[model samples]
Target: MAQESKPVAQVDVRNIGGIDEASVTLPEGVSILTGRNATNRTSFLQALMAGLGSRQSSLKGDAEKGEVTLVLDDETYTRTLQRRGDSVSFDGDPYLDDPELADLFAFLLENNEARQAVARGDDLREIIMRPIDIDSIEAEIRECKREREELESEIEKLDSLERDLSDLETDRREKVESLEAAREELESVNDELDELDTGIEESQTRKQELENAFQRVRDARSKLDNIEFDLETERSTLSELKAEREELHETIENAEKPDENADRLAGRIDELRGRKRSLDDDINELGSVINFNEDLIDGSGIEIYEGTPSDDPTDALNADGQTVCWTCGSEVGTDQIEATLDRLRELRSDKLDERSEIRAKIQELTDQQSSIREAEREIERAQERLTAVETEIESTESRIADLEDQIESKQEEIEELEQDAESIDVEGYDESIKLHREANEIELRIERFKDEIEEIDDEIDKREAAIERREELKSEREELASRLTELRTRVDRIEETAVEEFNEHMETVLEILEYENLDRIWIERRETEVREGRRKVTRTRFELHIVRSSSDGTAYEDTVDHLSESEREVTGLVFALAGYLVHDVYETVPFVLLDSLEAIDSDRIARVVDYFRTHADYLVTALLPEDANALPEEYAYTESID
Candidate 1:
């Protein structure tokens, strides 16, 4: 039986970087690019990077345009680079739409940021965390907090409404009981009045007169009862309005006043916005300069008027080295340009951080301004409500006084009528008079009871209606709580994961390499206070620590600078691999490119390759012929590109 052929990725390049034309097929697992120096090994890697949607690759000097085509798993992606004056523009759909993750992690070229960060002792935390949008997360957290606060307030209102239910039910029951008793008393009084009757002779005239007087008394008493009910209602209303007025007064007193310099904050925000715009322009210009210089260093489009470039152009760059400044057309050192570029990069990073801080500051100020405006509106509304309540209280008090006066007048009128009826001086008239007076009292009591019962029913209906909203408010509050939890932990979770991944991979790689004196290497996540704007905020930092063993077997901490070139290279590669895994880059881009590993010996290099091979579908690395010999016989090898 014949063995099945392994899967392969074929790459075609034309005039990209130093490559005039090249075709290479990479197999699954490790594929080695074996050659001596200046054999276009790095150039082919650049071409591959171009086909993977990286803009870092440059067109060849003599070629006006360059193209790279990649075929993997029967899927073909192409990238075209066109020379546009001092800059090169790339067009075409490539393997990855966004190459930021690939550039930072999967492409481990010598100049890759993640690899260089460890070598240069750059902020490991910043590089590992570059992909996360912390500001957006924090903003979302703030929004969740606000929503939760609103939900809490609504839930409180629902709870208060629910608590009042029992009291309202009790009041309604009491009013109903009083009504039943009054109706019974009224029936008794009516029966008693029916039993008393005057004789026939004096009954006709005197009975009619007495009946008129008694009817007038009854009418006065009924009016008085209604007037007294109005008085009670008005008094209750006045009491409620006075209580509301006091509350409004307290609200106005407790309301926050806006900042005295609130208007100045708007102006400051505008100023920061202008500053950020200026920084943007500077960063763009600096980036263009850096790209152009880097191309020149790569010997692309620089042979027209200059002396012959060095075979290894970057090897000649030193602090004292001199070269012609392309922009100013003056004699300047190559190292000076590189140093300037480095400074420019640092400046750009600082400005970018400053811009982020300014953005967050602007959001903070805007929120504060909105809150201040809301407070002002609240105070204004409270004042208006207080005024309305005071006016209502005065009107209700005046109405209550008028009702009291009417009650007194009606009472006097009833007394006069009673007196008139009592003086009739006829047989059986007094008994009839007393019965009529008693009947009037009972009737008034019954009317009052009816009015009370009606009010209680209305109140109970309102309380029950309000309590119906309780469940909905509770549900909303629960959702807000869940959202807040997710938002608050998002940043912390990412930070912890990154730290753990780095420490774990670093320990494993150090053991695999078996560095004689190296004890351990790890990263610790720590927090420190940083002053942003006028406030101090806590921020997380990643601290890289190196442990080394002395001859006596005593372990001590070491700095990155003390690590050998081979050790540094291994550490950097491990760090990049950690990032690759942390970002899940393998799921999208299956290829990992490695170069510039001449510092590590062949045996350890093989071991390192073996370690990284397990994590990628295809691991493509460039090596010298001697170093490539150390790899296993089964690994695919491309000695020359055609």
Candidate 2:
């Protein structure tokens, strides 16, 4: 079971000068009394630590009494120590009803002193000398750090090697790729050169073939021109012969037209005969009508009076036998009439005679008609020769077409031959081939570099193995260094413990006249060294452990380096308690007047109360409203407000 609920204490506050009357009650575990500043609160606490039951209680050990006290553990008693002017009643029995003793608390106070003299345990005494041991630890730390530095240097060298190899490998790979690309380019250019050679040959041969064909065609055209001239002369002579033949044929056909001329002559004779009969009829009729009124004349030159045919000449003759014309009114003379009649008969006779002569000429020509057979045969021969020459021209055109086909075939073959001859480069090609060879050399160099890189990689692997070995060596060195440092620190602490023990024994003798916990103290050698790959350890390496005690013979054996805040302050109170306990032994004054009694805090005060409460000697303590409330259950009734 844990500790049960303990009793609590209450307190009241008021202005010592100008502060408020603040108040509170406190429960037992380690109650804290907190507030703002300028409360004059600590003054109230200072008055409480002044627990001098007798006049000798105020004496210092070196002065009169050795220890001091407060109300605790029910009562107080005279301590063992006697000062120059104080009195004592027992053998270091300062606390009368002392039962509440805490060793951890007394150690806290002693080790933190200017020198740890009051402690009776060696370990308890060693804390005061902790600072001096650090020098030994520093030496070992330096050695370990040196080893770490050496390892770091080795790592840097390996890193440099790794980088150099990596860069070389990269450069080698790039050179290899360059060589491969050059090889490909060379092959492509060679193919293009071959095609260009073929093209050059084909064009040259075709141009030559075209020149020869053009010459052959020119010669053939000259021969065809002469043949065309001969043909044209023959065609002209044929045209002349044809024209004469056609004219002779037309003359023969025309001479066969005698009936045409006879028709013309008969038509004219009929017309003349009809004219004479008309004249005779007119003269006879007129003779019948003119009885003796006119004399009739029957001569070739004489004509009867007949006016223009448009007029009635009969009406013109008067009743006397003759009359004048009605239109011109000419005289109607018998001779004039006879002359017109005679002229008409003579014109008719002439027309008949001319027609008779035309018929006779047509008859003579018809008897002389014949065909021009010689001219016809000559024209036929000329036309046949023209046809023969035209046939030869057609045959020559066919032969020219065959020659053109033969030339085209020969030209294609010669072009291919010319292109093949040109494809083999005689000048620049050697340079291109040399460049390709150099590219291959570069590729070989790259391969060699790659092989070297592989060897370097193997070398790097071996170096890494060495680096691992170095790291292992460093690790061992570091472990040894750390141990050496710890041992040296121990050795220093042992020496310091011896010194602290001597001082603490003196302090205990002064305060209690006894140091019973001294047997727990001893010093040990601490430092060790590495020899022949082994640690030569020391058997005794550090200080001994010790404990402290109160006047009631209670022990305090601990280290105060780790004490809490309240515990630390209470440790100070214990120191004060030792002074009070030795009150009667070194008597001079009755009171232990103090200031700032709250410095120890109420929890520790309560602890002190339980140890000195019965205090066959009386104790008086003060109560500030705040601090008084902080008194714990173990010392609840120990407080007495002043």
Per-residue lDDT value at 41 in model 2 = 27
Please report how far candidate 1 places residue 335 from its true position, in Å.
Answer: 7.2
**TM-scores of all candidate predictions against the true structure:** 0.72, 0.20
Cα lDDT, all candidates: 0.79, 0.38
Give the range where candidate 1 is weakest over 10 consecutive residues by summed lDDT. Answer: 297-306
Root-mean-square deviation of each candidate, in angstroms?
A: 6.6, 79.6
**Predicted candidate 1 versus true structure: per-residue lDDT over 1-642, tens digit per residue:** 113344789999999866788999898888999976556777788899889988767677678999999998789999999988876778998999988788889989776778878887877877777777665776687677878888788778767766887886787788778878877877887777666652334647777787888888888888887887788888888888988988999999988777645567668777877887776556544544555465455433233235565656444343556655655656677677778878877876676567667766776776666566667777889999988888898888889888888989898988888788787776766667777777778777777777776877776787677668777877887887888887787777777887888889888888888999999989889999977667787888888899999999999999999999999998899889888988888887888999888889999999999999988888999898999999999999988763
State the lDDT at 556 in candidate 1. Answer: 99
Q: Model 2 residue 203 lDDT?
A: 55
CA shift at 168, candidate 1, in angstroms? Answer: 2.9
Q: lDDT per residue, candidate 2, 1-642, as tens digits? A: 123343443333232111133333334433332332222223222212112221111121122323323333344433332433222322333332221121111111212221222222222222333223343455555555666567567656766665676665666567557656655665675565455444443455544453344334333333333344445545565556556555545554444232234345445545655664454344322321221122122110112245442223244445555444322546666556556545643443344344333433432332222112223344455556545545554555555555555555555654554344345444444443344334434444444445555665666577666656765665665676666676655655445544444334434332332223322322233444322212342333234333555568677665545333433343344443332332221122222222234445555454444443332122334434465565553432323211
Give the clash total for candidate 1: 1
Q: Cα deviation in Å at residue 432, candidate 2?
A: 6.5
Model 1 regions lying over 4 Å from their true place: 1-15, 20-31, 47-53, 62-85, 89-98, 196-479, 587-591, 633-642
